[model samples]
Target: MANDDGMTYADAPLRLGRSLDIATNRYQVSGAIRSVGANASLPTDTTDVLLETGLPAVDADEVTVGDQLRIGGQTVATVETINAHATRDPNQHRVLVGLTLATISDGDTTRFGVTPVRRGNTLSLATDEYELDGRIQRVGTLEPPGTPTIRTVTLEISEVREDFAETFHAGMTERADDETIARVTNVDVEPSTLITTGDDGSVNVVDHPINRDVTLTTDLQVREATTGTTFKGRSLQQGSTVVLDLGTTTIEATVVNADA
Candidate 1:
């Protein structure tokens, strides 16, 4: 028998074997699981499972939090969050889905299904509720690895209102859900240059600067994840953009530097 994709049953074993090899080689660094099936069970004893997919950019938007995952008319899990990762193929982006599973059983498979959820194995899942074709990437607690630490990050705001920049001072904070996410420790503002191009294709900087370049040093909780250091759920790395809300105003700035 063959599936719509023209993949026959004979191809299953080869695909599964290849996926297992890929998973083993990339497990530690990539955190990718290519497939799962009956011969395997959950790698760890946990209710939280992380699924990975290489969904087309157009269809990726269909995944969201609170989406129900069902099999055979039985809802087995709920999507808690979605994280995207870039890949060499721009058309197909990789995504990680954090799932919270409810009680489920399939013979010896027990909580997950009839098969042991291994690192790499193709697992057929229902798509009636949420159209998803994912392989189990991880089976363990989804919480942050360890306690967060205070880190100082410097950001550069290319343009800002002069008045706002003057009034913005240290001790101001950005919060989410009433929890402080970042606190400004220092602020520096300077005249920003304006650039213009002539008809000859010559680039020039205007003599009179109209904008202010605001540099801010902020302290925030930085947590480590399997991927890397993260601040406010985003990759905390140089050249990344971060948005800070100071109650009265909001500012988006590019990270200039960060303390390791």
Candidate 2:
């Protein structure tokens, strides 16, 4: 390996300003330069960026905190912490994390980058700006016996997508199982006024004076909008009001009469 600025690695690990060459990506040490985190929305410094791409299993050392970082050829930020796992799977061995990027790290730099490779991965962290620029160190590989690793294991928050369907489904095939389905029969959905009965057995207020009877619809669907699956409601309604019992939160819904 060749040095970036007239220097070479002899024996004892390495010091600041050394570069780590994993596959084709070069991690240059810039400790002499100040890093400014370019992240926001968060109120603290807690972001973890993992570089799980193009890294060799046997030749990639784990990352540490306070290391100025770069990934995917972009200056992401500084690493707040390094999660090391002594496992056979090189990918799971390390998880480069960037918990938060809101608070400044008592310096002046901005951004870190993460580049993923096939047989291995690179985990890097970044501050709100970039506080790990010149503070990056070359993460070396593990000692003998471990195969040079390669693969990509990166997880990022894509974005807040909208106007999508929400669904949750799990497929299961089983035998010798008793299946049961329950339904409510006495409940009727009719139009009625809502009244909260007072402790004295009297309603606190009759909000729906025109509603004589009520029907209730209390069904909840727990799922991600991006997915495709929903939970239908099973309610008991009398007129336009329905009685719902959802754990701790309870709400009363009135039926809207269509053109009768």
Candidate 3:
């Protein structure tokens, strides 16, 4: 009988029987048939794709390894690894998600929420528990982290206390949790200039200096990761601010220069 495709199936069983006979004869000539084990397993199909989201770090932190991903109530993949990086916005983070493939239908697109899982596709990531809506900034294998190295960074603390500025010196260490992460190699202090604006919005610098500003040259050990070179979860780059904890006090300083 022919179906809608106009293909006859009346002799399909006979054809299958003949094909099985041919295979049996070949196997017999070669050797005894190997018994198939019930517990035999096939190789798993997995793809490492980058998933980006604008979710806050707190929410992004929820997507850990070994998490299951599903769409339309069907399991599609498993989370293998995750890395979170802060964006320009202090409140938002972009996350990388590595996924292990599962049951995905042909031509059926997988989506993180309503966003399709396509390269450069911007969408939010959603699971049964958390709905993290954002964009997929990248798609490919995750790059390995680079080796850690000691990098020189220049930081400036404006309008610092006179006593602290006078006592600040090289060999001072920046500590976090009682561990030193950076050491000051050089310290430069200059009189902080006082500026005033005129009625016409013109700026004027006063000759008299009131406060002191200290520029600190420090060496910080850092590693180049997918996000960037980070120390204590903060990116160490020009224009970024890092808080240094001295034994006596803590000071927030803006990075003016950073070594590549």
Candidate 4:
């Protein structure tokens, strides 16, 4: 990693883009692990590569203050602040990724990142960004919960979707009780996002909108005659999949008609 000669971090020996990897030495800040580097593409808002893995566990206790971390043989970042519920445990955790620069010398460097993992008193650092998701299988008759189930059979996809939101919605089957009732589950919605699936196979998404179809009807009744949400000549039914306006958003209903 090389920077212009004029710049300097005399106080902190760190910057971004400096090949920081797993097992790399780390500097601690606020009880969290962190490294400093310099990269033009790094814009704290939405970096293409988030060194913090997919999402941290939403466990407040798990995030140790004054802990150290690294990736790919190098130190990457330290836990600056945690912006989540402390008392409540969320399904996914988002950490604020900040490069630790004691001075300006560590800037303009290319480096790898590492994550801290602990299981039953065993703590190790990892150098991979991993995510959890799912696949689909076609199934029979619709009447699904809301989001389509992964199709288990052919010609009838179960409408597989990655559905993992919060834990409070774990055992709640309100959708199964009444088809007319509109229920919302806040969770991650794609294979890239973590989908909460128990052994029995249930799914829910976090903070997503329902049936925002330009071609589909707001009433959410699947029929050729239905006007608004008509995709592929058919209105959406429970457990059905339709490409919503170039496939930006996905809307799958559990039953054919919520009103029915």
Question: What lDDT does each candidate get?
Answer: 0.66, 0.29, 0.62, 0.28
- For model 1, what is the C-alpha lDDT against the true structure? 0.66
What is the Cα-based TM-score of model 1? Answer: 0.49
Per the 3 Å backbone cut-off, how many clashing residue pairs does candidate 2 have? Answer: 103
| TM-score against native, each model | 0.49, 0.18, 0.47, 0.20
lDDT of 3 at 10: 35
Sorting all predicted structures by lDDT, with the top scorer first, yields 1, 3, 2, 4
What are the RMSD figures for all models against the true structure?
Answer: 11.8, 21.0, 13.0, 19.5
Q: What is candidate 1's lDDT per residue for 168-206, written digit by digit as tens?
A: 899998654346768999999987777899999999987
* Clash count (model 4, backbone only): 81
Best by TM-score: 1
lDDT of 3 at 124: 40
Between 2 and 3, whose lDDT is larger?
3
Q: What lDDT would candidate 3 get against the real structure? A: 0.62
**Runs of candidate 2 exceeding 4 Å displacement:** 1-62, 70-75, 89-92, 99-260
Off by over 4 Å in 3: 1-45, 85-94, 100-119, 144-150, 157-191, 195-254
lDDT of 3 by residue, 45-117 (tens): 3445655455675777677778886765766667776655444454555565666545222235554332445
Residue 132 of model 4: what lDDT? 19
Per-residue error for 176 in candidate 4, Å, reads 33
lDDT, candidate 2, 22-112, per-residue tens: 3424444423222213332222343333332222323224344565544456443554544322223433222223322323233332232
* lDDT top scorer: 1
